[model samples]
Target: MPGNMVTSEFLVDVDHQRCRRCKRCILNCGFGVFDFQSMTTADSSKCVACHRCVVFCPEEAITIRRNPLAFREHSSWDVDKRKAVWKQAQSPGMILTGMGNDLPWLNVFDHLLIDACQVTNPSIDPLREPMELRTFLGRKPDRVEVVPSDGGYRVQNPPENNIELDIPLIFSGMSYGSVSLNVHKALAIAAEKLGTVMNTGEGGLHQELYPYRDHIIVQCASGRFGVHSDYLNAGVAVEIKIGQGAKPGIGGHLPGEKIGREVSGTRMIPVGTDALSPAPHHDIYSIEDLRQLIYALKEATGYKPISVKIATVHNVAAIASGIARAGADIIYLDGFRGGTGASPAVIRDHVGIPVEIAVAVVDAQLRSEGIRNWVSIIAAGGVRSSADVAKAIALGADAVGVGTAALIAMGCRLCQKCYTGNCSWGIATQKPELVGRLDPDWAAERLVNLVNSWSLELKEVLGALGVNAIESLRGNRERLRSLGLDAATTEIIDVKPAGR
Candidate 1:
């Protein structure tokens, strides 16, 4: 009864003067926060500002606004900080959160400035001239063999293991259980249409998606859910998820309540079973162990390229070097601002580094170690736009992974309620009623439009730099400099301060 007591952190005001109570607001609300039996208006405490009830309401009577409770301002002990303390004191459990970190940290992306070509060096026209965005993810051979054959020289010793991407953008892993089937289908179709790749986020590939195998990249996380030889072969490349940026050094457990028939089938688990992913793979205790598994998967898939994904932690650069030496053809680095299906608020906000610094530091380290070309880098976490994608490539990432942006393109509002499975946008939720709201066909078009638009913007920047191809931007730090940053911070990102 104490917990059942209603609290007004947000205000839900209904203009009763309009008088017609069709109850559209209650019917549309999936949170079941409305008590119509004795209600004048929807409960304010449960209102997430999802705008569902407001959008579907027949009468323009209901309005949702925050209560805006004020606490005496204290810089050290802010309202959120004090409230967080009270929450834990009342119930000793980790605070559950969704999406990326909302904390105000140093976003290195803001300080890094990009360059444009001057009259001395003519800028290329992407509309008329050629601009290549095609990229390959995998190990490259040290040198090409020129064999004299008959009257002409013949090329030899080609690396069969590779994952060719028509564009430098990839849909980051968002599992089937975390999101609806329609969302997955949209990503698959978009990837196929764009000639890029979509990752099945630790969830097994659905039977319906088998047709899009060429554009699929299967992830084998610590849980190993839905992993099989067939699944390995189905994808052009297989990624081993060592850790996620949202919850570094911690395991994840999807509650049994979320498990549905489709999710069960895809994960090869029984219904009502909690899907658990451990912090570390039981077999992968060291770099050697990782190498063994990478080789094993490659062998199983007849030498398909293997990708090892790790969060951007303190020792990320050293860890990346170890992974590169361990024979992973591709290294996937996820930063602190990455989104998650669900994660502990403490971990999501506090763990890992930013993607900009991670990519820059790792790239510099790999180059110094003389193994930069041995493995491709895919920068992830908080890649919000094409500027991010272009900057990431310039920071030495071969490509970038976008999860939250792609979800938003499919109509997500970033309400941070993904853990509740009541996403009105129909992308994050699995509820049958809510899932029906999204049309795969429509969602795919939106995703295609988003990617194509961003790609065009990328080309525009490349043209202004007088670079005709995207590859020429990779590791070209000379084209970027800091606006105003500390010497130590600039040194970490390995970019020079403005004005030489």
Candidate 2:
């Protein structure tokens, strides 16, 4: 026997009395845990606890549980750390993980509390009052020049190009090869229905999505995958992806196993080849280089709104200021808790800061520099609920971007096995059999319901705060108080103590 054998994490049990031997569990499970020779048998070692079999069993015969056998308890070397070491011992390479960081770190949004109207101020009822959630994302001129027209006054200088959203929510980017085509179709349909925008990650836009071009934000990343003159002008806006929060300061790699004919055609790469994006854009080494690209994109796209996306780092405020000066109409800050198709375990859990702090610092810096109106800020990563949306606006974000939450509405169970390409839920897999499990129309309806529910909840939150419009809450930190937070943290987020 070999030393340091990796113990199974999940235990799968089969009840013969309840099981009909219909072989449904074998067909439903993508991880290949169930088999039948004489009777139904389960290989507990292969289970990832995805719950597909348990949910699909006709007789409810399958049960999955955590393995009771665990390593000797230790405070520093936890179960995950020990298991990781054991796995690396067998196949030595960088460890890869999917979804967001699963580490037990502090979530800043949980500590911050929103203030409501009390005795002095009267709260408005959302059902009775009109609450505005419409948001325009783009640059705004500091001053507008108006001239007298035949009927009235006309603005000689109009505002910069902007995209209007019915709700202050956007679907974050999840690439084509990383996720199934049905997932992309659902997101596009939902964005069109919600009157918002959806990002097409680094992967180029599939031809089927061309019809929804007016509601899309095409991305131009380090690899420049699928970028062309037609693709640049196809969307309402363009996003220049500098870095993603999950793996900051590193490149992206989509393994050859996931790249099929459709993905190859869309990304303009050959089939069965790994799609690798360099760590940094070769043409962009300085702020000046970024400015050139920004202008080049603008000149190519008839001066459409341009957004620059960056991972939230310690010096994010300074970096955002430079991006604003580089003529970007929007700044997208992705925090540490963002999701990804695949990323190194070390970077996803340890790198990047939270979006809350990034939003506060960037907004404050731009305001201090007298350029707050120069660009709109979109804060992404770790946004989970409607309350988080309201708090993000209060912390100075013009809008919030959501990724993992949308997937959960479409039946994702947070299994954290997205990188394996065996997603039973069909949200992260490229195989035809798994991808067919999800229907775009059904998934789109679920996503539409999710956003509509959040929109209503946001209006209720606004009514409780005695604000009829969401714009009133923008950058208003006085309405927030920090609880169970240190003095330094509260100061950094610009929130007062709970009592005060």
Candidate 3:
């Protein structure tokens, strides 16, 4: 097999006349695409189009674009397929990838439209009237009990262990080893600032971030990395990560090279050793078994709201129902398009179902079972904009999680090179030099701004829908309509077709 069988995926052009010999591009790029001996030279084959050089070059002399090299066009045997075959032949191994699925599947959210108030119902102006975005995550009782007070009746019972959010959005879990500590700090700061929560993935919470414990959701993965009594009690809520949407039925491996001193310390693993998480919790084979862990964490955390996270699959609705019945206060549904630090390319692109469908089915199933109030649904994966957040809430999600979008707000370019442990923007890599590039304070500000803008947009959405609060939109399928969606999809989503 020839080593050069795979063609370069990108073309890098550096105009010498405009190049100032500053060497900033070479310094900024984590990938070794540029070399400057006397004059600057580029290895186009090595470029991943991260745009580090293009952005850092003071003279703006660099341009990175897709290679124009053409291959025979075929419906099935596309360029990517051909390239993968060639690369595998040269070096046989499972093809690892990063980020979310990039396939061109139809996004269900795009086909679904939110209905606005007209004629019969009057719309509320968010600017003039109060619009409530505040939401709580926890199990709710069927009814509340009240006793007579001095002046008015007061509620004798209130929901226990509920996590309040000003914006009904969570910063999804991205472990320490998978992403830089600066990213975690930024998320924590932003969550605290915005009155929401940030999840401390399978990686244990770093000691430095303990100050933000009130705004965190600590995870207990199959490997139980960094999980202890202190770790569990540190967060307002605890999450058992049964599966991630990026690679549904597989284990996760954080390469030894990326496990630095801090990562090792936080995860409680030896430095330079690969951190592995088994596909399923060893102790959980059935719903009964899952129930045991959920309660155990609840016990460990003094009965804090327990969350069970699972990947969205064909039977996600059933799985979510089981989780709720098993005493989980929150059911986190991660869709196929969720981002990850490392995942097999084959699994990331092909395995799980879309989150939009999962949210609809799960919400409907839980409602039918009369267990909807038993667990708060947090939908994730492929949530790109404010419209997505609104659609998710309307589809029955109590709150939504944003992973890739948060990273992008923190300067991620979606270059899909995170698994390489050489992130130029400092959002993914643990390397000291690379990590130093990111300022947590600045990144936190960016995140705060992003969420604030989204919250404002959500209010606009609520006002247009003639609702004064986000609570009214929860599982209100009547406020939604399908556009160009097939009958089956429309029915499954429980939204009427346009003009119906």
Clashes of 2: 0
* Overall local distance difference test of candidate 2: 0.93
Query: Candidate 1 lDDT, tens digit per residue, 37-126?
Result: 644567777877777777777777788787777778999997777777767877889889888999999888888888999989999999
| Native-to-model Cα distance after best TM-score fit, residue 447 in candidate 3, in Å | 0.2
* 127-214: candidate 2 lDDT, tens digit per residue: 9989999999998889888999998999997775889999999999889988899999999999999999999999999999999998
In the order shown, the candidates' Cα RMSDs to the true structure are 2.3, 1.7, 1.0
Ranked by lDDT from best down, the candidates are 3, 2, 1
In model 1, state the lDDT of residue 408.
89
Stretches off by above 4 angstroms in model 2 are 144-158
Q: For candidate 1, which ten residues in a row score worst on lDDT?
A: 1-10
The lDDT for every candidate, in the order shown, is: 0.88, 0.93, 0.93
Candidate 1 vs 2: which has more TM-score: 2
Q: Is candidate 2 or candidate 3 better by TM-score?
A: 3
Worst 10 residues of 3 by lDDT: 1-10
* Clash count, one per candidate: 0, 0, 0
